[model samples]
Target chain A: MITLTLLLISLLNGGLAALIFFRGLKNKANFFFFLTLVATFFWIFGLGMFRMSSFENGIYWATLFYISASFCITYFLYFALFFDNKNIGKINFLNHLLIHSPNIITIIILLANFHFIKDYSLEPWGKSIKLGPAYFFYVTHIVSYMGYAIFAIIKRFRNVSGIEKTQLKFIVFGTITASIFALAFNLFLPFYTYQFVWIGPYSLIIMVVAITYAITKHHLMGIKTITSEILVGLLLSILFVNIFFNDNNLWFKIIIFLVAILIGYFLIRSVFKEVRQREHIEKLMKMRSEFLDIASHQLKTPISVIMGTASMFREGSIGKLPKEQQKKFVENIYRKSVKLSGIVRDILSASEFDTEKFSLPEGRLEPVDLEKLLIKIKDDSKEEADEKGLELNFIKTRAKISPIISDEFYLTQAIANIVDNAIKYTKAGRIDIMLDEDEKEVIVKVKDTGVGIPNEDKSRMFGKFERARNARDMYTDGSGLGLFISKEIIDAHSEASIKFNSEENKGTEFIITFQT
Target chain B: MAKILLIEDDNDQILLYHTVFKMNGFNIISAIDGKIGLDRAKNEHPDLIILDLNMEEMSGEEVIKRLKKNPETKNIPVIILTNMDKRKFQSQMLELGAEYFWEKTVVMPPDVVKKVRDFLEKNKIK
Candidate 1:
């Protein structure tokens, strides 16, 4: 009964460790967890050997398993610390070595055949070891290490909320239950009575089951796909084991093995593909909701302006006797309507990028005059810059610049977006829109003496709906899709590229280059 | 006539509010940005200030915080007229001692004048 139970515990722990390690190979927490379970597996299996061995050999097996127990407790502590994606570098190497010093010293004493265990005596029920001077050391080591693991988890539990809090909750419950029972049955109870030593190993099942539940239910390590994958793998392994034990001929066995291998490969592949698709769909849903949030705010402003101005005209509330005032109100409505349409067009253009079959629309490509296009952008952005009391300059090249074959509408929109961003971010300094060219390329550089992009924000600047922290604080109304849409539009044009150089609190320069 | 300060960066919004307030027989002074708005609030001593949140040089929140901190401009009621989500800023604005937090898109210019008129009457600010 003892042998079979130990074998079951070892198998269970080994399987779990393998599954978690394989699925989350890159995660430090998973790696430490793998070590913890492997240590537990070794300790339990060693305990079984200690039970079956003779008096002399029983002492050796006892010492070996005690060493494994020490490692098991230490690894459990490491796993708890590393869990929740905490970076390993946070605990420096010297501190790590300091943490494991006691374990290391205990391992050395056990290996050197010190007075850790005085003797081993065989009895009717089981074999047990007599306590030595180092026995107190071993007991203290196990109790304190296990206690600290639980304590660390409880400490982390207070700082977290939501899913992480729940994840930590299960870990705390499992580790505390398993540690208490294991200490009572395996560590303390064994000193007084040997009858319940086996119960300590069985208590580990509670820990395993709790963590497995957490993994399958919560997004612990982002491996919720582990459940089905492990099931399919276990089922296939059982089929392979059954084939090996069959009374079939050698050739029959070989053929069955080949077919099983082929089936298993495709089954796992399909499961992986399905999980990936589900994750992708989930990401799209999150993006759509975020889009709607910003869309409502941006779209509402212009609509509000149009509706408010138009309503005042309609109601004639203050008695509109002056024709000049009426004309101004009419113009405001027209301007706001045009602004509303422009916002809607930007949103539509941004959504088009989400579709898989998206490409620049045909027949929209035409030879666009660089000078004419740029002057229009300057004229359009002048009112906004002038309102902020900043000079907007368009410096034309001395040499005549030729036009490029491109989508005239999108190209203009992309360039205009850059200039608009410049005006938005800048407070006082002048924005210089300089057009220059060489034999290979035509370049338009929009430079501003505004608050420049931070180093951390530069890489993700062109990502959809991603705004820098400073930018978000500075301007609350930006949808953060301007640069993303601009990049896409520029990339759509063959041999065209957009790049920028920015220094925080200094300025930013965006250069768009086109093939002549 | 109550001297009203309109602190908005948008020209069209400024125009709409300016014309409405003028027609309603209120003396309206306008500032193009938050910095100018703060200066006007302290210097002009307007009875009520209509502030826009997002601006280039300074923000409306900063303006309000400064106004409430200074003795000269602290008593004047500030009305936040913004295109931002009202739910996110309504409580925050009120906590900062703003008299009213109104979404620009939701309230008409005439409605804003009436709100201002009602607030001035209730507060007994001449």
Candidate 2:
């Protein structure tokens, strides 16, 4: 029964070590933990064989077990040191040699058939599991390395939080518990009561379980992205193959295989889904900050214009001039204040539109005359056009026109937005507002002969807070939300769409068609 | 009197800055945009420039880059006079050979005239 138990423990260690070590091959910290697990499997296998062997060769097997134990302890120590990477300030080559000397010396002695074990006796346990001059050396080696690992882990735990703290806690508790069991079964029980030496190898399985749980459950390893699925998938496949060979019952093997494959598929899919979501969220965060920068940069100009002009009049920078001069400056300040208010209103509307909350309360649409609306829009923008030395034109294609059913306020703002944009962009030539009606649609066209939109900027002209590359150079006062708000209002009508055609350095023509 | 060429697009600002600088006993010749500013810089050969950051056909950055490249205007010192908050481009504008950065909204027009007067008195040509 003891031999059977030992083989099972050996197989468990081997399977876990193969999976993790395969996944951990590229990483230094994980590779050290893999070495520790591999050594534990070798120790358990050699000890199990020693129990079933004759007295003459049992000593050799016992020697092999001791050599493997030394290697296991050494590997666990190195694993603890390299685990967090932040704790390793300076890697001393000499200290490494000192820590490893015991393992190297023991393997050499065991190979030479030296006096670490002079001979063996076949008691019920069938081996002198812990008896040698170097026995004390092995004890000190395991105890000291475990002490060092505990110290390193505790030091690292204080500085970490979140998932790393949880992972390190598991590793620390597992290392301490495994060390105590090793001491009780191998050293204390064998000397004080002379039994339970066969049980020592089984306790090593606890350390293996703890490390494996950390890897699979907590994802303690920061894996390489875009290829993490392949590695984890390969590891699961190896585990399935191991189960295929180990189980004796054919029905049990097939049932377990199907269940594992089903669970594994979902696990990998969820991990991929989570990774992609995180990547997308990070991109949005970056864009949001950039949008804020542009918004603040654009909004500051109008605010400064209002404040600067107001103060210029207050300080009498224009001197004690005629009443006409003072009146013009006051009008300039009033105009700038209105522009600032417009910027703030557009910003609020754009933000509301972005969140999909901008809507008319209800039943706001009304019937309106198209000719009268176009005339109002042209009249409102005529003063602005004259101020810039540009002609504003309104052309009636027909003497009379049909009226369209629409939201009057939104319709007025939409047409006004198009005409305002035309005047703003046109520094020299005339801006013409032409009205034409077909059988099914009424179209309002705005054409400008100023600085036209660049081809690159035209595609994104209707995007919120988007402006042409050279638009700011032309006029620094625009908030970049006029065209976007116009687009939104037209879309809300559900019967109209705004389209534009432009050539760089020549002109642009915007056409708004409303379905009748 | 030091000839100061003020390049700005706003009408009110041009009238204000011209009145202030002229009263401070400096010769003030101004343009409304960057392209005209560059043309006048070469033709008039002013002793100093007051450049605005915003304009219609060309940017102030482009204007300064061309001014520094041209042999005729490379030696004159430039003072930036606009509503732009200077923290974003103060060091870079100085490196581009602008001698001072004055935010237009914060400083009084007379205060700006005083600063320009002090600068000219300190670095006046022999």
Candidate 3:
């Protein structure tokens, strides 16, 4: 009965350790836990078999039991010493040597038949071994390790306050309960009366329950993802353990093994796939938030200027000046308005792509009036050219031009972007616009005598977030989105295209062809 | 006269503000960005600061954090004037010890000056 109970406890403990090993391999504490549990499994399994075996079989089982017990005690000390992830224990090489010396020596003595236990007899449910001369020394060494673990845990408990204290509460309860029961059965009762060694292993199950509850429920030791993995691992453990311990035919066992391996491989692969996908999603979310921050700031800068100038005009601050000075303020507000509206449209366009909401309002796309659009772009950008002490003018090269089918607002934006780029690049010369048309297409060209696009920059000049070398050097804060947005808007119409001709540091002209 | 330090980068907003604040006969100091703003705050010892949240060099949140940490400038009242969405940072700015928050898109130059005057009066009352 006692031997069977020990075997049951060993199986249960080993199952719990296997469950933790799924996704818990990254954690140091879990590694130590695996070591301690495996040692316990071997110790209990060997000891249980020893008590039920014949005399010759008893010696073989006893050898395994004693060796496994040494491993159990050594690893248990290591686990207790470093259970808390934050606390670095004072155990050194010398300390480790001192702690496990007695365990190592006793195991060697017992297994080598050097008489750590002279004789033993089966007591129906347990074993009775006649203690040798070295037995008292071994007891003191093991007891010291237990005392050391208890003292360390209590000291840590006293130092921590709040949630950590609560986690330690579980650990303290488990360690003390296991120790007291193990002592009562293995040491005190065995010396004075019949051995009840099976009681020690059973009480350890309570320790396992408390610690597992702490790990999963309280989130101690940061054991995340192990909960769901445990659910998957538990079912697999039962299935696999049954196949492992079954005394079936060799052919049946091999078939079961093959099937189990196939299922386990796919199960592990799926879990990792989920983990990778989650990490990728989190990275994308972080980048999107950063972009939004920059977008908000970009939108805010021009809006503040537009609103401030408009507010100034509304309050008669600019109108109170002479008519000559007053016209400049109105021009300033108009210039700010064009930049403000252009930025807003760009953001809206980009967000549609980002959020996958390609919802454009109906009837917004219509025949764009070529003459009025060019006049407005020239008027709005007049102040921008004047601010830089340059002349901006528009000329119609043809008597009549056909209107183009496009979104008027976006068409106005694309023309404004071309003119804005002219104003930005031209340092000391005039920006001129010439409009002409043939039977099939209407053309708009903006020419500037300023630093032109380099040969390398012209290819990706219209790509999103790409800027010319001189443009970025001249203006530090430009978003490089103006031309990109304009290109996207023009490209949406199948027959519209933009072309440019440039000589570096001399002059450049941009031509937009809209098929009527 | 309460010396007000206006930390803003936009040239048009700066011109509008200079006109408004000067018309009201209040002394004003302007810093174009956060790095200059922080330096001027420590050296000028302005009675109040008007801070814009987003800037090229350093952010207004970082400026406020440094100001609160420096004992010499920690007591000066702050008025947050920004065009960034106000709801996102209103409570956090208040908790960071800003005296008033105004969205520049909504508040006009006259009302902003009036707010400065009103905030000074209420602070005197407290």
Best by lDDT: 1
Q: What local lDDT score does residue B59 receive in model 3, on the 0 to 100 scale?
A: 75
- Please write out the lDDT profile of model 1 over residues A1-516, one tens digit for every residue: 575667567657766776665454566666777898898888887887787666678777777788888889988888777763374466788998987887888888887867876766777787867667887888998888888777777777787999777876776788789889989988888677766688898888898888878876776434535755566556555554454354668677667656865675566556667776887788879977878877897788778778888768777853565777677777778877877787787898888886753456778777888888999999988988987899999998856998888877888889998998999999888999999999899999999999899887899999888787778878877888889889998888888899999999899999999998
List runs of model 2 lying over 4 Å from the truth.
A1-225, A228-290, A317-319, A387-389, A402-409, A450-459, A468-479, A503-506, B23-25, B69-71, B124-126
Better of 2 and 3 by lDDT: 2
lDDT of each: 0.81, 0.75, 0.75
Tens digit per residue, CA lDDT, model 2, A89-179 = 5568998788789988877776775656554555564456436576666677778887787677677778789977887776777777877
Name the candidate that leads on TM-score: 1
For candidate 3, please provide the TM-score of chain A on its own: 0.50
- Per-residue lDDT value at A348 in model 3: 72
Error of 3 at A349 (Å): 17
Worst 10 residues of 2 chain A by lDDT: A220-229
Q: DockQ for the candidate 3 complex? A: 0.37
TM-score of chain A of 2: 0.46
lDDT digits (tens) for residues B1-126 of candidate 1: 899999997788888888889988999999988888888998999999999887756888999999999999999989999887788888999999998899887788999999999999998987
